[model samples]
Target: LIRGGRVELGDARDLPFTIKRSWARERLTPDVHPGGFVLGCNMTMHRDVAARIGYFDERFGAGGPLRSAEDTDYLVRAMLLGIAVEYVPDMTIFHHHGRRDRKAIEKLHRDYSLGNGGLCLKHVRH
Candidate 1:
């Protein structure tokens, strides 16, 4: 069985957060890894759980509207299918956290809206 989770990315000045496991869910407190859960870093090719889960929803892109909830959809579906999500704070990755200007923002909104709507149609219409 594969377990996965999500982590928050912080700025250089901010302390990176770690993933905390829910003690209540453990049958017996594990010694090897005290935390019953596992790691969840963003877009790491080697250890990313999505290789077992699947790829990003192509309906999402930088300038797309439906993009915001793509990750939420994946994580929710994984959980519903009984996949475990753990938070791993020790891992670090670099991401481009660029600020978009008004035009970029507008494009993203429109594209994401179209992409999300397209996803709904493709998945539900059949």
Candidate 2:
């Protein structure tokens, strides 16, 4: 992790800031929707769902102006559109963000905030 601890995407029980105690540690069921907190690195969807939702907004992700929240925005769109989402806790993978230096770490946080703000604006305007 950038700040020194493990970035446990599976179970965020150790994290104090999350509203849900278990975070991504949910049983595989349609009843459990990940909402906008879904991580892009660990998600799968059917092609039809992709077709229905189009693609992640280019203006909100890593290569775009916002530099984050593309996954969040995509899932937000899915949820808003009434798409059926299921969280599969059994399927997992490691995410190596590679932000080692202090500058990179700070930039990550900055970009995250900026992206989040932009996402909020976009949704609020709609």
Candidate 3:
């Protein structure tokens, strides 16, 4: 899955930072080679990766700090399963990060609290 708010579509030469283009511009270069080039782009992620590693844990809401790590945890699980995450430098989109409104935040807090409790119960039972 694409991470973070900023995204663009192009090769590394067109990047705002110093980057090398020829090195695996449309693939996961860092996983393949330490010195290989990298690209930052918005991707419509293929479903094959999730077909094995499972989907995001919707239990955590955005407001809770620990909730933020849920995505990281999912990505880590994906990497453990030997899924190759490719960074397509030629296609990108800038995401707009949105915060919840006050009411939304309050509702999220309640949901998050219940979700964490459920998680604890599951672990305890397991």
Best by TM-score: 2
* Stronger candidate by TM-score (1 vs 3): 3
Candidate 2 per-residue lDDT, tens place, 1-126, comes to: 000111233433322221222335432233443333446766677787888888789988779999988877777677677774555444545445554457776786787788888888887653
Candidate 3 Cα errors over 4 Å, as ranges: 1-43, 59-65, 98-126
TM-score to native of every candidate shown: 0.41, 0.69, 0.41
Worst 10 residues of 3 by lDDT: 34-43
Candidate 1: deviation at residue 53, Å? 3.2
User: Model 3: clashing residue pairs?
Assistant: 42-92
Segments in model 1 whose C-alpha atoms lie over 4 Å from true places: 1-52, 61-65, 100-126
For model 1, how does the per-residue alpha-carbon lDDT over 14-65 read when each residue is reduced to its tens digit? 3333323233322212223212244323423234555666765655544344
Point out the higher-scoring one by lDDT: 2 or 3: 2
Q: Give me the overall lDDT of model 2.
A: 0.58
Clashes of 3: 1
